[model samples]
Target: MLLFSRNLDKLFFRTLEKQLALTYATSTEPQREEEFRVLNLKHVKGQVAPRRPLKKIVPPPPRTQQMAENQDWGNVWPGPRSFHPATVPLPVRQGYVEKGVSPGKFGNAELMKIPNFLHLTPPVIKRQCEALKKFCTPWPKSLDSEEKCERHFPVEVSSSDYCHSSPTIRDPLARIVSVKVKLEALKLDARARDKFLRLVGDRYDEESDTVTIVADRCPLKKQNYDYAMYLITAVYHESWNVEPWEELKSEADMEYYIWENNASKVNVEKIFGKEAKDIPQIEVYSSAVDKYMNEGESDHTVEQYGQAVRKILNLPSLGA
Candidate 1:
């Protein structure tokens, strides 16, 4: 019985092994075929990639050759920029070379590095002016002549302008302002004139009778110009003023010698008595003395003074 059981167990185990082997072979055979197909597709794709064609380089045409003679210059150069020989449409050349010639417009480093004003050609300027003419007003009919203009506008303001390729646009000298006006424009009397001269010091020109005021303390040109105008106005108003103490000033404090306040006037008054005003020649004598004292004692002035004194005293002349 044990030998029969052993033989049956062996047969059952052998059948189960055969069944498992067949199942595994059937499942794995399709999986292996799918993986092999996927790998073949990947290999075919790697081998069949389209090749990119190499680009062929082509240079641009020279702008000078393309430019027309009747082309608008304004369009060519609308603003300031580094020089470009090709765009300029001119036979421009730069750089040093041997006896042959300078470098042509093909490659000019010097020309490209420098600034150019090709945009401000005469035609372009004319076109710009024509375009801007509508915004500008015509000159006034009343101020036709320079004299009339000066009469109406006595004060002249002066300033400067500068242009450069700097980091800052401002110029130090541009902030300085000069204001000038004729002394006659103020219509000042002798007292005011004297005061004005004293106040302005060396700024007053005796020959031209012009007052010049310069202002540069302010940072901006407009501020300096306004300050200069303010100074002029202040000087004019201050010069016209009279203080209470001015009336108390004695003859010694006077700017020029006055015949009316001199001791000669008192002596003449004593000699002529209360009728000094009645004497016609007394005025002439006073004028002679004033001229001698104020205008320096010249030979002519001294002779005039002597003649006046002799006439006033009723003395006989040596010539007579």
Candidate 2:
């Protein structure tokens, strides 16, 4: 009889569960239905016919090997690289999020690469001490040694003295240092004169027969020609970093030749006419100059260069 009662109870509960599950699956407001079941189902209804409960049916437990073979892990993986955001898994989606790894992020870790030497004038030794205290790490080599490690930074002592001279005024202050007759001056024809003037200039007044030219000089000795050339190369590198030699050299080489001839007088009679000998001379400030001159005939700009180039190209000026 006890066994019979237990079976009957089990069947009743199973039927109730099935009915509840069906109602829940269909009901949009299932929470309300749960409340109703708890509150309004206390009283039994009249004319209670003998209710035959449906037989409880459960499928067989899945085979472990079959499940293992058939299991889908698409959910674990982030969907295709092109997958919609809504379908991607949490871990996979968050993996692409990049948090900044900057200097402040690493607390107490030496984050900055300190310079080996102080660069500013009136060096800050105190700041250096503080930085060393906070970030210095023990390395295999001693600081005094010249040997540098893969990560080794070395400090060197250098001394500099600052000397102030007169405020530079480009009042044409060029002094003649030395004057020598150019050996090649005899070969300076109309073309050579034009080339020389391009480097210097044709600040010559035909009426006055005064001629002027400009040249740059350095105190460097003859032995330092290579070093001086390097300095000139540095100047060229900075000025015409992108310009082609084809555009600049035809003129620059001539100018360089004039510089190589330093302190030499060249005849420009055929180029500047017989009056060229009377043109005012404008010598550029160089260690070779005797004195710096502020006054000359006339300085030429690119626009004024037409007359000068005509002299070189042997072409009649448009003005003429």
Candidate 3:
């Protein structure tokens, strides 16, 4: 039994330690107190600050408000450009709407899409005219009448310029050039004038005595103008040009009656011999017959011819 006791004490061995009373431990400690901490915020490092509200911005008043009534428009709008609401002092509006006034200039497409004459005011025009006056020559006092002007400057050129709200500034009709001039201005002889009239066809206005040349074959205005001028020059020179066949044209092929080449002159010569050529009465007879044949028979023509015949043959006038 003593040996079993010795084995039990060896298996359940206890460690030796020094012990002190509770009062002695309380006295040895420097300071002993109870303490508390805030819940769930012990790990936070910095102090929290409140957020301030954002400030609202107010824009400056419209530029037109500061403008004066007598302000120079030329300085306001220096040149051609799209319309601006703030720049223009006027209350102009354009866009259409149901049961509403025209839309204001701000955010308006109608105003921007079209051109404005803001830079071309009356004062501006006067200033431009004054500046240009030095470079211009004064009008000739001698050309007081329209007829006088036409007599001196015979050629009248006409063309058009178009302005519209379109995708492109160019208009097809603007390229066409029209040139007109009086036929008398060409100073052509009888044969040359007849040839010119034939070459120009119906372009000639017999009543106005003017010929109009229209050129639209070219794409540009200047090109069409040049083409029109070339046509006029060509027709003028061509009319004067004489072909070999022209000399072969007989009396029968003549456009008008020729009193000198007719049998009437031959018979008259046979009657009076060479003296008919010197007779003043024979000349009047020739003019009357020429007019009667060329101008178609009329009362005036017949009366004129009868008087000439009476004068040549020394007969009494029927008017008596």
- Best by the lDDT measure: 3
Each model's total of backbone clashes = 0, 23, 0
Q: Summarize candidate 2's per-residue lDDT along 31-111 as a digit string, tens digits.
A: 544334355554656547888989999965423323343334332232223222232222221222257543331121221
- For each candidate, the alpha-carbon lDDT, in order, equals 0.86, 0.38, 0.90
lDDT ranking of the models: 3, 1, 2
Ordered from best to worst TM-score, the candidate numbers read 1, 3, 2
lDDT of 3 by residue, 78-165 (tens): 8888889889888899978998799988888889898888889999999999999999999999999999999999999999998766
Candidate 3 overall lDDT versus native: 0.90
Model 1 C-alpha lDDT per residue in residues 1-320, reported as the tens digit of each score: 99999999999999999999999989888454443434456466558667899899897887888988899888988998778766877788888987878888767787776557789999999999999999999989999898898888888888998765566879898899999998888999988988988999999888977889999999999999899988888988999899999989988889888777778878878877865687768988988998898889899999999999888778987689
Instruction: Please tell me which model should have the higher lDDT, number 1 or number 3.
Output: 3
Evaluation by lDDT, superior candidate among 2 and 3: 3
User: What's the CA error at residue 319 for candidate 3, in Å?
Assistant: 18
lDDT of 1: 0.86
